[model samples]
Target: MLKRFFPDLYVDSIYHIPYETLKKNQIKGLVFDIDNTLVPFDVATGDQRLVTHFKELTRLGFQICLVSNNSEERVTIFNQDLQVEAIHKAQKPLRRSFKKAMKLLKTNPKTTAIIGDQVFTDVWGGNRIGMTTVLVRPVVDRDEWITKIKRGLEKKILKVYLKNSNNQ
Candidate 1:
């Protein structure tokens, strides 16, 4: 189905997300993809700005979790600042990790959102479980070769998605 790869919302960056609006919608938890979604792939920790934002989200009653397909060493180090529940080698676009993320936050699908920069992994997995999905632009272009290939496919899907949205 078209929803499988289509994000519920698109934004320039995670920093620009309207958390208040999400709260208004009764979204209680968020599962985020670490690399590119929160920061670039090479970054090891959340900067003060990002850490503060995460803290504010927590203050607003949103449980957050970091789910990544990267190694534990990478995800572990990157999560040191935010210090929320985290899972590594998530194997996203698969329902298992998404389910685990929901369990981590102790939230149901309707009240949880999955945020990431990739459609195939993040959006697809979220949609599969009927959870809201948010797509943000990648922080940088230096992705692994596998991801780079998926990005190519994502561009084509985006074109189709745009055409459909315009028609609607």
Candidate 2:
């Protein structure tokens, strides 16, 4: 159903997330999608800004994990400097990797949230597991071909979701 794709929160980008509010709500762990969620597809590493942001989150006592469908090489290269728990080739929208992430964070669904750009993969997967899902706008317009196809469908779903949300 369309409700499955509807994120608990939708914002412009990761930078727009209400981290303090999440903290206040007792969200102790965060699972993030890397490419196009935290950085553009072409970006190989987290920028200094992102690094600092991660540090801030850690200082606030939040456990973090990066989950990506991309190859291990890609995820490894990206996480080399950041050093947070990471899962590559995640095949998301499937519950397995998400469970694994929660295990690594030592957090349960009630205190964990997933942040990503894709509604089908990130939002739906997290929602299925009872984790708060935060959908952020893609970091860039360009996307891998398969994701490009999904994006078109996501737009339609978002239209209905937005209408329903506004009416509420």
Poorest 10 consecutive residues by lDDT, candidate 1: 1-10
Model 1 agreement with the true structure over 84-148: per-residue lDDT tens digits: 99999999988898889889899989999999999999999899998989999998988988898
| Candidate 2 local distance difference test against the native | 0.94
Candidate 2 deviant stretches above 4 angstroms: none
TM-score, candidate 2, is 0.98
Clashing pairs in 1: none
- Candidate 2 lDDT over 89-113, as tens digits, reads 9999999999999999999999999
TM-score of each: 0.95, 0.98
Looking at candidate 2, what is the lDDT of residue 161? 92
In model 1, which regions exceed 4 Å deviation?
Answer: none
lDDT of each: 0.90, 0.94
Error of 2 at 64 (Å): 0.2
